[model samples]
Target: MTTTISPSRKTNEAVRPAKQPLRDRLVRLQRRIPIVQLALLVLVCAYGLATLPGFGSWMSIKSILILGALVGMAALGQSIVVLIGGIDLGVAGYIVAGALMVTQFATLNNVPFGVAFLLATAGAAVLGGTVGYLCHRFRIHSIIVTFAMGSVALGLAQLQVAGAYGGGAPVWLTQMTSPVMGTLGLPIPPLVLVWAVVIVLAALFLHRTAAGRRLLATGANPRAAELVHIRTRRVWVLAFAFSAVASVVAGVFLAGFAGNVDVTMGNPYLFESLAAVIIGGTVFGGPGDYSRTVVGVLLLTVLTTVLVGQGLTGADKQILYGLIILAAMAVYGRERRLRDQV
Candidate 1:
């Protein structure tokens, strides 16, 4: 033990660097991703302000926020489902259905708006829950299940409307989304405030609640979750149901924002919601939250505005979105799954 090392051996030992602990590396990676994303957000905003006309103006900024809010709302259910290792392809269908049913119920059935709203959301929840239960019971992939269900939903919605698509939103609904609209006289759109409240509530629910923990456990490893008595199937059903509800609400708000309802209006959100979740660094299981999604929503909104300012066509924008999503998945996909980490 007392033998002296050779000079070369001593030099080699001195040059060798210490390996970082695995936990430390993991924590660093978690921190680094968000920081990099935030930096990118800031850079994009600064560039927009510098180059895009009126990009720094309140009107321009408000428009971005409002658009981001709509996307964020639609992405809410996608976020929940994806957290549990599933995807919801039916969001667009639910959005359109909710929009159509709400208007039709109020106008044709002569029901109160509140009753119509309830009926529309309730119908969406039923459809979504059925999809969730079917996928879990049959051990099928959610993508297939949700896609077929979405088609069914769209078909039913079309029948309900009898092919007619245009209708004005209620005045209060429009006011809620108006830039000049305020909650409690705050001078900001009530819709934006509602979005903010949703963000807070969602963060709290996912991070601080027992049900949230169960949901995460189920997603991380269903087998392990079951061993501990967590009902994975119930989690799936509830998650998709919630997703349907969120998408429908977003549809309702979108109708107001657009001042009318159209069957195809919700189509863009199907892709955009998924894009926002992935771009926000939320993996398919565990460790992602609504806050990351909010960041993603903002990043996407700003980027789209800049692209519009640069006069990119709709097709060009779609191409860019695809590329950006690919790049994001490439980076985030390499991370170890939650079960693997365990």
Candidate 2:
């Protein structure tokens, strides 16, 4: 002050702009993220289509959509559990059990189609609820419990199959889900429509309902939520129940699609569900949304379809898919940490 500041220094100080609000910056960053990811996905799909002959064919597109729809349903359930800071390792088990139940009731046991389907779903839900209770009451880790439960479920399915091969789907279920509706020669399966509806409903529930807020809070910080009088355990139980219900619905579609039930039908979906959730930008133990999961499913489906269409073997496709999922997790992890730091 005694020496008087230089005019250049004063001008420099005066010209500095105020920093942007942290929330505003975060919002802007988030807005850009989805667009970037979507653009990348689209580009990858386009590259595959351009380079691979027949990749853009109607059959190819329909196959991709159908596979994505099935995996996406299970992935949605997994996402719910992951959002609640839990994992359901019993996805394959529940799906197998549900399908077996449906098949047995409708075919072997000669029950009504509608009744068989409802009972199958209910059975799966009960199984899920029991697992949830065990985890909550006995302080068992969900992963271990669900994994063990999956084994049990598989064993039960095998028992039901009893080394027999030819019990097909009920006529009604097959007729209702077949014919593959679409627009302008594009094949759109009913299962795809079902998945779209489920995802949309789930998104609305999570974003616009109090129960969803509680569920999210429980996942974000169980202790804090407990202190605020939120029944964290109940939320967890419901999450597990929902996961089971979703798996059963997926099983119904699988049964309809395959036109038969096998003991091993649901085994592949376990990993696929996990992959879809992670790829969908739902970080473990963090905020998750259904819309992102849908994108994740589509990306995965497209990638797999393109690879298969290019004559890549199943094993190679799986390896590449794992790599992609790892890359996605890395990116999402960095972004999450950066947000926390800011």
Candidate 3:
């Protein structure tokens, strides 16, 4: 004899919560993806701070945050362009140009901070728009146009500087670059607060708004986006414009943080920003998956600090950075393949 259960009882049992299988839980955690980046971040921080005697100081933390903030800003912009299936090689140029223009306006022309900022912003906008136009109008690869623009920007910056440029940031900007608060022997840089605020705003922009969703969708599948009557060109233009804004912001803060900017200052940011985005689990030319890319930026900053403590040369750091980028790219490629197969 067999007992039969009532349908209602079966339904109730089905709806009841149950413990997830370990394998299933692991799969779910893996799917979250960013958790991997978070884990890596923790691992790196722990290793660096534990091994390096002077790496865990408040000064060290603040230094990392300030540098990370600059890189994070660039990564944020690069992520935007990459989300739309494009790369902005011109970011370095925009950054350098913005930094130079800001200082030149304030120091050379003696303009107010507000006016100088607007002018720099306008310059970046025009540059961004030009890059977008080339991509849209000529059907050129974003890389080609942006790369050329980067060269042009460097030249422009050099011309503007005219060989000698020297100035200090305003008192307000200086204060922001310095520490804003401290508690329990830990000093907090205002730049960190600014970075956090920007991250929150970016998270909201990318997740909460229809426009942001549209941008991501466009990047993920331009053909499908166009089929759905989404203005894909406009999205691309918007992405570049936003990127320019980000680079400019980074430049302004970099000027304040470093007390000035040189022609070569923005060079490293080009690769560092891309690495941060990828390591943070955001794939290039895929759906914009920014699981707090700032974490990746901070990890790199910590790594840099650790390397410096170990007296590693720039070449050593570059090699390590390149290896990490390649590894991340492989992971991204594999994830994409698995997604496609599924």
TM-score of candidate 3 versus the correct structure, residues matched by position: 0.87
What are the per-residue Cα lDDT tens digits for candidate 2 across 1-342? 378889999999999998999976865676345654576679878988798887787766766778888898888788988888778999998887777767764566677767877876776677778877888889888899888877776676557657454667766566435545553454665666677788789988998999998988877777778999999888878888889888887887778778887777887888888887877777766766777777878887787777776789989978987997899777767654322432
Cα lDDT of candidate 3 equals 0.78
Summed backbone clashes in each candidate are 0, 0, 0
lDDT against the true structure, each candidate: 0.87, 0.77, 0.78
Better of 1 and 3 by TM-score: 1
- Reference-based lDDT, residue 69, model 3: 86
Alpha-carbon deviation at 52 in model 3, angstroms: 1.6
Cα lDDT tens digits, model 1, 1-342, are: 598889999999999999999977866776445765677799999999999988998877778889999999999999999999999999999898878776754676677878878877888888899988998999999999898887777788778768667656789998988887778967678889899999999988988999999998988889899999999999999999999999989988998898878778888999999999988888887668888888989998999899899899989989988998999888777767888876
Rate residue 244 of model 3 by lDDT: 86
Off by over 4 Å in 3: 1-28, 180-187, 337-342
In candidate 1, stretches whose alpha carbon ends up further than 4 angstroms from where it belongs are: 1-33
Model 2 residue-pair collision total: 0
TM per prediction: 0.92, 0.85, 0.87
CA displacement after TM-score superposition, residue 237 of candidate 2 (Å): 0.8
lDDT per residue as tens, model 3, 268-321 = 999899888877767765744555477678778878878888899999999999
- Model 1 compared with the native: what TM-score? 0.92
Best candidate according to lDDT: 1
